[model samples]
Target: MAREGVTMPATNQHNEQASATPNPFPEPALEYGENPARFLVEELSVDDGEGTSGELMLARIRGLETIELCGFWLAVERALANKESREPRERVERAIRERKAELEEHGEGLAQTEMTPADRRAVAAERDAESVAVLVDEGGEEVSWSRQSGAAVGASR
Candidate 1:
């Protein structure tokens, strides 16, 4: 089944085998019902003592509607945890800041304006959909962390 852009296997045939298989990377300390498998994976190049090498890492998530906010939070966590160098770490930090700004801008529209609970929910949903559209248009396949101004992007509450 597809939830947002994430695809879950149609059948449970692999459930038993998947449970038996060990995860190649360390399991993230996330809450229950937060499926780490739905997180976007990226191969990042890291500088080792000898030379630069690539490692599998979690990138900023693109889809998964239910956990969009949580996924972005986890992406920031993963980005911080994985980077040791100043330059790379700063880049990740800047990206996260931009994403947060986007969310805040979108949220600001809802502030000061009073509406009924149902109206509030509808407006919130509209803002979320717009945010996703912005992300998709700006980042294409992956949410770009590069600095940009104006439009709100990424996930918010």
Candidate 2:
């Protein structure tokens, strides 16, 4: 969902071909199937003092118009920190630059307040998964995903 500025060739996976077999009815139907997992949130949310902010974020994200935009929001949010105007300029600049390419890709002036039903489910899963009681902290490191542990087994390279 790159919004406005950066340009890159995107994978056009949304395209689907018509069924090879012909139907006697003459009309055709659209085929649709893609695992919703790609839209899933990747990391845990940082617990800022007020637990309410995260809940709000999730709620707002669920309201976003498309799954594609929701995925982009997750990226931009992760790249940002500190709402304080007093924070260092470099930090804000970095955050903006980190997402500039994406901002460009999403096609101009997009709003962040909506989501598709599929987007809603993906965000809901992320929120539900956040409630899990135990997690091994790899300390800002990468870890291997384990179906058994449902945790990062070790630092990701």
Candidate 3:
């Protein structure tokens, strides 16, 4: 089943294949229990072929956390859709909302990002000003909007 000119590499003691050439993109060392579950962005750049540079970013998530988050979100969706799961769904939703409210109160916002609060606000304001379809509630607070859903989020500090 081996293809012509395609030879399998010899495995080392760790079961990893021994390569003749060193890998440019070596694996990053990560500790699971040391850090909380989160997303990390590693930004790179490439030429756009028009004298402009384009961003190449990596949104890195650890293996276990990825699976756990996917499972949790799926369960939440299923529970919300099923009438029989109303009680459990409500409790879960309430917890999430409360946590979100607490985070907002503490000015943590949601998730970790590299951008400072001021920078984020500036970007949000720029986007809102550029877009004619920006959604604003009756309170008219300046908040960041979701890129995908165009929904207004928590007010900026």
lDDT of each: 0.40, 0.37, 0.36
Error of 2 at 139 (Å): 74
Would you list the rank order by lDDT, best first?
A: 1, 2, 3
Clash pairs, candidate 3, are none
How well is each residue in 52-109 modelled by candidate 2, as lDDT tens digits? 4344434443344444444444444343323222332343234344444444455323
TM-score computed on alpha carbons, candidate 2 = 0.20
Candidate 1 per-residue lDDT over residues 14-107, each given as its tens digit: 6764454222222332322233432322224565665323222223321222334544545644654555332334443454455555544444
TM-score of each: 0.29, 0.20, 0.22
Worst 10 residues of 3 by lDDT: 34-43
Looking at model 3, residue 47 earns an lDDT score of 66
lDDT of 3 by residue, 119-145 (tens): 666776897777454455556644345
RMSD values for the candidates in order, in angstroms, are 16.9, 21.3, 21.5
Best by TM-score: 1
How many Å off is the CA of 122 in candidate 3?
1.5
Candidate 2 stretches with Cα past 4 Å from truth are 1-53, 81-157
Better of 2 and 3 by lDDT: 2
